[model samples]
Target: MSVSQQVIKDKLQASIGDIYHIIITDTSNGCGQSFDVIVVSDTFEGKNKLQRCRLVNGALKEEVAQIHAFGCKCFTTAEWSKLVV
Candidate 1:
């Protein structure tokens, strides 16, 4: 079974809380086995890179286990604002 992009996006929003922005991409060409993601949230404000990764991984624990590959870049709203500017 494969995961849908919406499922992942929804789960992150539900689990992470206070999401300011999010982008989810299907990287497996419809196989749903791989994804590339970016999440911007206040929940990440005080967290480091590893901590952010762990939070995202924990939120998507089951999905991550089932998928062949998953890549996520997490940031605080402040960090994201800087990047987009």
Candidate 2:
């Protein structure tokens, strides 16, 4: 597609402040378009998965409109620590 991985990362960096690693993939480009964004920010604190997804959806409305889908996994720094999977 027209957007590059770094571009997506940058957009996310701007939109989702405090993100630790804004990993992006573009399946549309036959690479890894399906993003697995690991954001370690307080912004995601208290927000459930659905709410986090919605927040990401709203934040990336412009990019979302262009992409096929999003494989989002947002988490707070604390929540990320408790993950076993």
Candidate 3:
């Protein structure tokens, strides 16, 4: 019944749509209790950091309640492109 990284990634991709990139890491080192997620998508356009986090939190509400820790970094496609270039 524990939430896995793939589950989180799938849910996010489904909720947000058209993800440019996504990386979910199990920071708990195999415990499956904590995670770090980095997502880049156009769904974040015009949203600030807090707003973006809220959107992600809302999408993962149920899964987050089951996990001990969830860290998310969301970026718009433009923002992500800037970082990589």
Candidate 4:
């Protein structure tokens, strides 16, 4: 994990409570060469995917600027569990 990852994870942890899991994949160049983040948290509550992703973006504003592309899969714990069901 990079500094940005830790900073992001810490900020997210504060707002979301216990994180079920977090996965960050560092990809290649161009727009596709971006970080793909999957965050599972209870704090997502009534937020839609866009809202949850926006929140994460807000939390990592600086980091976002440093990268060319950004991608995220945000999920509430309940939503994530349902995916496995």
Candidate 5:
């Protein structure tokens, strides 16, 4: 069975907390084999890109194993503010 975008969003939100936004896109021709994710949260503060990626990877460990492609962009609240404005 494949996971829905809402399920992915909920799981990340539960693990990371204090999220400004969570966007998950299914990019596998509707097969649910690939996903692109953007996560904005205060939990990523003080973490480097790799560290932030690791945090997301850890949160979605089991789900990722089933996916063939996973692309993630993570940002802190401050970083997101900078990017948006």
Candidate 6:
């Protein structure tokens, strides 16, 4: 079964607590095999890139198993704010 973008978004929101921004792109041409994502949340505040990815991966453990490719960029709220400005 292919996972929808919204389902992934909801999962992230539920697992990560409060999120400032989330961008998810279906890079597998709607087959749900690949996705590129950007997530901004305070949950990443003290974590390095690997740790942040682990959190996201842990949250989406089942989904990640099904997906062929998944790429994610995680940032703290403060880091995201600087990039957007």
Q: Please, what is the TM-score per model?
A: 0.94, 0.72, 0.93, 0.75, 0.91, 0.94
Please give the RMSD to the true structure for each candidate, in Å.
1.0, 2.8, 1.0, 3.6, 1.1, 0.9
lDDT of 2 by residue, 1-85 (tens): 5545676677777877677545465656555445445556678888888988787777777766765666677878777767735
Model 1 TM-score on a 0 to 1 scale: 0.94
Off by over 4 Å in 4: 1-7, 14-16, 29-33
Candidate 4 lDDT (Cα, 0 to 1): 0.74
Report the number of the highest-lDDT candidate: 1
**How big is the positional error of residue 10 in model 4, measured in Å on the Cα after superposition?**
3.8
Give the alpha carbon lDDT tens digit for every residue of 1-85 in model 3: 6799888988898898778999899999998999999999888898889999998898899999999999999998889989999
Q: On a 0 to 1 TM-score scale, where does candidate 6 land against the true structure?
A: 0.94
Runs in model 6 lying further than 4 Å from the true structure:
none
Give stretches of model 2 more than 4 Å off.
28-34
Higher-TM-score candidate of 1 and 4:
1
Candidate 6 residue-wise lDDT, 1-85, digit = tens: 5677998898999999879999999999998999988999998988999999999988888888999999999999899989999
lDDT of candidate 2 at residue 74, scale 0 to 100: 83
- lDDT (Cα, tens digit) per residue for candidate 5, span 1-84: 467787788779888878899889999988888999999998898889999889888888888998899999999888888999
Better of 3 and 5 by TM-score: 3
Candidate 1 per-residue lDDT over residues 1-85, each given as its tens digit: 4589989988998899899999999988998999999999989887889999999999999999999999999988889999999
Better of 3 and 6 by TM-score: 6
Report the C-alpha displacement of residue 85, candidate 5, in angstroms.
2.8
Model 3 residue 6 distance off true place after TM-score fit, in angstroms: 0.8
